[model samples]
Target chain A: MTYSTMKPKEVRQLIREKKITTFTSGLCNGYAQANLAILPKELAFDFLLFTQRNPKPCPVLDVTEIGCPEPKLAAPGADIRYDIPKYRIYRYGEMTDEVTDLSTYWRDDLVAFLLGCSFSFEGPMLDAGLEVRHITENHNVPMYITNIPCTPAGVFSGPMVVSMRPMKPKDAIRATQVTSRMPSVHGAPIHIGNPTDIGIKDISKPDFGDPSTIYPGEIPVFWACGVTPQAVAMSVKPEFMITHAPGHMFITDLLNADLSVL
Target chain B: MTYSTMKPKEVRQLIREKKITTFTSGLCNGYAQANLAILPKELAFDFLLFTQRNPKPCPVLDVTEIGCPEPKLAAPGADIRYDIPKYRIYRYGEMTDEVTDLSTYWRDDLVAFLLGCSFSFEGPMLDAGLEVRHITENHNVPMYITNIPCTPAGVFSGPMVVSMRPMKPKDAIRATQVTSRMPSVHGAPIHIGNPTDIGIKDISKPDFGDPSTIYPGEIPVFWACGVTPQAVAMSVKPEFMITHAPGHMFITDLLNADLSVL
Candidate 1:
């Protein structure tokens, strides 16, 4: 069966049964996908405040009740512990384990946050006829740690991480208009051109993900990345943390159109 | 001095000195005003989640760190304890005191939340040549408790409260377009035309605020109100709570234009 055409529930059930262990990109096309960040109840308030303060980089889609594994708002009846294809476990900011399911690690004191992913906006961009170079090239989008510092909340503080896509000047303007409608996802480009202005050292090298080609006359447009919470988590080095592996995400029943504000 | 012409800082300073303790409705004309909700650290997480779930009714503008009295994002350097004109103190859901200063009641475990008020959108509506009945009639906007239940967060659940404005169908459509740009301030009308459909019984009598004149041929339009957090607080009956009294608000340095997403 083609996974991309399946319903979100069917796909989630397959992953729950340990039948799909790969990235969730391109599956359940037109549905919204989310990034996961599970933290203890103690850290939840501070972390939630952080997302609130810096909404562009960390627009929250849904937050599960304390100790509840179900994301009732984004996808009711979907279990956070097993719906995602992959999970990355961290201890004191260092990678501890990679698991397909979190049943062994689930705790009553844990709170899961489902954050908006750039993938939710990429479909809209493609629909707008703008070329997303990373998808066209079949590689990860180039990401950078910029000089722009995020508004700090409690113990969480770090520089903003942005994902870049190279497009012509006209396409860049059109892309801005397209993505601006969806604020629940990273809304609009943070910087359209001149990477050095935001303290990006080199266009060819990125701190995370693979660099895509920038053809002649095409400039790089940057949007806040979902990797931000993980970066902040690493900097703060909480005693324990859990996040979806890069490129792997939780799919929700909500259609991409449902996320548009306009 | 004309209070409407004064800068936000100047107005806030006057409020801090208790020289201006009246309703802040027309003060700082173009700036955004916020409703205040302060809760102890024990209830902060659940309350913040409630705001996140019900953005239409409780659009959060900024949240202070635990034990902090300054709303750094909305108005840096301004102290929350004395800046607002009035505050209502609630103890176990009972009205205890109405005061101009919160210093005596402030606690180290309290967190203050600044929520976007509908006043932020009223300016744009007037600029668009739409009539605002409450302002013209010199009465409080009519507010009703609707059957619409807000999405519950942990330990916090209550019926949604909405403020109503009567307008012709064409003006209602235009008003929708105007407010839709400002999502941070209770974006767009929740319902239009029918009162009983949303569980409102009498159009002339409101549960809170004063009833305004509704001309014949005009339909009643309802927008989610800032009063929701307070209503929820009363329902849940938290041990301690503090909120701005009706009509008196915290004036922020942010212009109303800054609140608009588009």
Candidate 2:
């Protein structure tokens, strides 16, 4: 079946039935895919504060009510527990289990948060004719943990993580203009030229995702990555946490165009 | 002294000295001015959540550390307790006193919050050649309470209050495009025309501020007002609350250009 051609609901239904169990990129072409984070109700306010403080890295798309599996704001009528293709359960900051569904682990005290992902902005960048190197190379975008400290919230604070895409100076400026309209998806590049200035020692060696090729005349541009929140959550070592597996995301019904301000 | 010609610090100093005690609409030229709110530490988290849930009306510029008298992010050297031209003290949801300095009532548990005001975006709108009716008439902009309910958080929930600016259809469109870039300052219009559509019954009569003139070819455009958070705070009726008197803003060191996304 052509998953790319399927509607977001159709894709979610397939995932719910255990028919599709891989990552969720390239599906629902024009729609937004969100990064998921589930935590106990006790930690929900602090985590929400963290996202509010560090908007660039953790732009909140939708937050589910306590114990509710449906993301009523982002994807109404869809069950969050089984909609995502894969979920990683963390116990004391360590990945203890990888699962396709959360029926056994579901708890009434859990709160789910859907955060904006860089994938949403990349669509507009590509539409604007800017080169998204990772898409061109068919690899995950390079991500680095930077020295930029996220504003500390109760038990949730860490250095911001950034995703890099190598582009020419002109393209970088254009990309900035393109993404600036989508503030919910990590608006604009944090750094455009020198990676070392932001504390990224080596351009080629990234802490997460695959490294991208930087051709001649192209410079590395970085944006706050969605992984920072998940990483911070892990660092805090909450007793139980659930997050979408890398590259696997919760597809929202909101179109990419809906997020643009202009 | 010409308030418009003086720098933000100069204006703030004059205000601190108890000399220039009036509305601060055209002061400091290009710099940004903010609305101030101070609440107890216990209510800080809930108030912050309220602002987060309602960014359009309550776009937070900077929040001071608990018990701090200065807004570290917006104006490093200025004292939040006394720098603003005037302040209104609220006790159990009622305005008990209107004072120039909060030093008399200062407490160790207070938290200061500076929210973005529409003045920052009005500069751009005027620069774009769109008519700002209230500014032309030399009166406070007309504001009304709308049927639109703000996203509730904790104990904060109230109808949205919006300020109206009359403009031609073409100008309204341009104004929307212009303000869309300034999200921190109540970005874009929530309603463009027909006040009754948003539960506003009479055009001339407003709940707050002076009436605006809607010329024959012009329409009343509404932008979420910074007054919202304060109104919500009043409704919730915390034991103690402090807010800048209407039109008396807290001047910041940051320029209007700094808040522009593009």
Candidate 3:
């Protein structure tokens, strides 16, 4: 069966059945794929406030009620515990387990948060006739830790993490205009020209994800990434937390067009 | 000197000195004007969450630090207590006082929130060659409480309130595209054409502001208004709250162009 041509529900069912336990990239092309972050109820309010304070880094798509596995808004009737291809468990800020399902670790006090991912805007960027360097080479987008401090909310406080994509200056301008319409999906680029200006010491070395090829005329453009929230959550050293493994996103029922302001 | 030609600081100084205690419409052309909401620090977190959950109705421009009278980000060196042309004080949701200065009610525990007003986007709408009906008729935009319930956060919850601008179908489309770029101000029309669909019983009678002129070829286009937050706050009936008097806005030093996502 072709995964890209299948509906979001079908793709989710395959993941739940363990038939598709892999990265969700290139699947469910038109639907939004969101990053998952689950936290205990004790820290839910503060975590929600943190996401609220830092929208660009953590643009929330849907937040499940306490202990509920189903995401009510983003994908009604979809089970959060089993739908994602892979899950990462963190205990006291240390990665303790990686699982395909959360049945063993499921707790009644856990609240699930689905955050907007850069993948949502990449589709539009590609459609706008711009080349996505990372996708073209089939590698992860380069990500760096920035000096920009996210507004502290309760216990959640840290510098922002950003993903970089290289494009020609003219294409960068068009990409900015295309992505600005989707504010829920990281909006516009935060920094357009120089990576060093935002505290990145080297453009070739990234803290997370793989490096991209920068053509002679291309400039590195940086955007607030979903990784920032996960990084912030880990930095807080919470008793327990859950997030999706890199590139293994939660497929939502919402269309990319649904998020467009225009 | 013409108020329009004066800098934001000069206009703020005049308001601070009680020399200009009137509606601030059309004064300080390129700069952004803001809606004011002052609440006790105890309720600041929940109120901020409310705005976060419903950004269309409450696009926050600057939030002052707890007990600080200065809006440090939006207008540096401007006093929140006396810079506005007029102030409205609410006691248990009742409008008990309309004062020019906050000297009598000033408290150390108060927190001020500056929200983006529609005035910020109107300049661009006019520049795009679209007629702002309310401005053309010299009246406030007609507003109505809609049936659409806001995403509740904490204790703050109420129906979404929308301000209407009547325009031809072509102009309405253009207006939407123009305003969508300015998300800090209400981004785009929540509902267009029928007022009854959103629970507006009478188009001629608005809950707040004046009725707009609907020409033969024009349809009512609604944008989420700043009034929604104030109305929601009143519904909560906090022990003490303060807001700007209708038509009297807090002028910010930030340019309207600064809020554009593109």
lDDT of 2 at A127: 89
* Most accurate candidate by lDDT: 1
Which 10 consecutive positions of candidate 1 chain A have the poorest summed lDDT? Answer: A229-238
By lDDT, rank the candidates, best first: 1, 2, 3
Off by over 4 Å in 2: A40-46, A65-70, A103-110, A153-156, B2-21, B40-46, B65-70, B77-79, B103-110
User: For model 1, which pairs clash?
Assistant: none
CAPRI tier for the interface of model 1: medium
State how far residue B223 of model 1 sits from its true place (Å): 1.3
Please provide TM-scores computed only on chain A for all of the candidate models, following their numbering.
0.98, 0.98, 0.97
Candidate 2 backbone clash number = 0
State each model's CA lDDT, in order. 0.91, 0.89, 0.88
Off by over 4 Å in 3: A9-20, A39-54, A64-71, A78-85, A99-112, A148-158, A238-240, B1-3, B13-20, B39-46, B64-70, B76-79, B99-111
Candidate 3 lDDT over B1-262, as tens digits, reads: 3999789999999999999998998888899999999998777766876787688999888777667798866798999999998899999999999999999999998888899898888899999999998899988788899999997755788999999999999999998888888877889889899889999999999998899878898899999999898889889899999999988999999999988876
Model 1, B262: alpha-carbon shift in Å? 1.1
The sequence of per-residue lDDT tens digits that candidate 1 reaches over residues A17-84 is 98888889889999999989999888999999999998889979999998899999899999999999
Query: What DockQ would candidate 3 receive versus the native complex?
Result: 0.27
Comparison by TM-score, 2 against 3, better one = 2
